[model samples]
Target: MRSSPRLFQYACRITLFTRQNCSLCVNAKQVLSTVWDKHPFVYKEIDVMTPDAKGWQDLYEFDVPVIHIAKTEHGLERPELSAKAQKLMHRFSAEQVMEKMDIISDPKS
Candidate 1:
């Protein structure tokens, strides 16, 4: 996968499922903010406790700070893209997230 570095993280939308009082969620937001500052993307936050959270509350109530990275509408659920392609959960860094994004963008690399 020979392409621009910017191409990897671009066009990716991140859906962050969180709870109101989760400290891990707070930290995850901070890390994601750092990544956004460098390379902006479509970032959406869904509070599991919110009434309008759709189905996120039931899916991730016990798993605060769960992050789903996708290039298109809710694709790439499999973690087999590599270790880097696994769904980010609990504790993660900007680098880990970026690596996953890169693999997602160019899986043949």
Candidate 2:
């Protein structure tokens, strides 16, 4: 009997919006680091205070240190985030990140 081929799934990338001198951002990074130890997802940090990030700063002024899971695609330098992916606050716990990862990873979600 022939066995079916195994399928491999690509890991999702996460974006962290942060700013300098922000205690919340610091705490969020720590939490994310802890979660990443187990979940293992690529993450990028965006400094909203930077001049190049004007748009991001305006949009997330009150929501600093936002965490967003990037949308997956076959080829793209920076994949767009899915509409279903909700922006998480900096206060989110490791467990919450895990739950979000599960939701984002689910094909049906």
Candidate 3:
């Protein structure tokens, strides 16, 4: 008997730590959406004010728009980021976010 081959898809989860009435958070979401148009991935928005994000408020209070990209594979999560990307996480532009996404998604990099 012959068996068919199964194909696996590569996906990453992008979490945006944001707060209500935050201008930076809005800008971040807009940038992320632009990036998503080219390289799509699972996107999640987390509000620091909620109970679910209790501890995060302390860490990301001032950093209203933080992005975390983690790969999902075989039920395991792994972060994919370069040193430059990490530095850009704090304060970055749409172009910078796209650049980071390209770096993380590129298999050869």
Q: List runs of model 3 lying over 4 Å from the truth.
A: 1-8, 74-91, 106-109
lDDT of 3: 0.63
Task: Look at candidate 2 and give me any clashing residue pairs.
Answer: none
Q: Candidate 3 on 60-86: residue-level lDDT in tens?
A: 778778886654442422223222223
TM-score of each: 0.73, 0.78, 0.69
Please give the lDDT score at residue 20 for candidate 1.
Answer: 80
Best by lDDT: 1
For each candidate, C-alpha RMSD in Å? 5.7, 5.2, 5.8
How many backbone clashes can be found in candidate 2?
0
CA lDDT for candidate 1: 0.74
- Per-residue lDDT value at 85 in model 3: 28
Candidates 2 and 3, the one with greater lDDT: 2
Q: Across residues 1-109, which tens digit of lDDT does each residue of candidate 1 receive?
A: 5767656444677878788889999999999999888766678777878887646676778978988876644454432432343369999999988877666566454
What is the Cα-based TM-score of model 3? 0.69
Score candidate 2 by lDDT: 0.72
The TM-score that candidate 2 achieves is 0.78
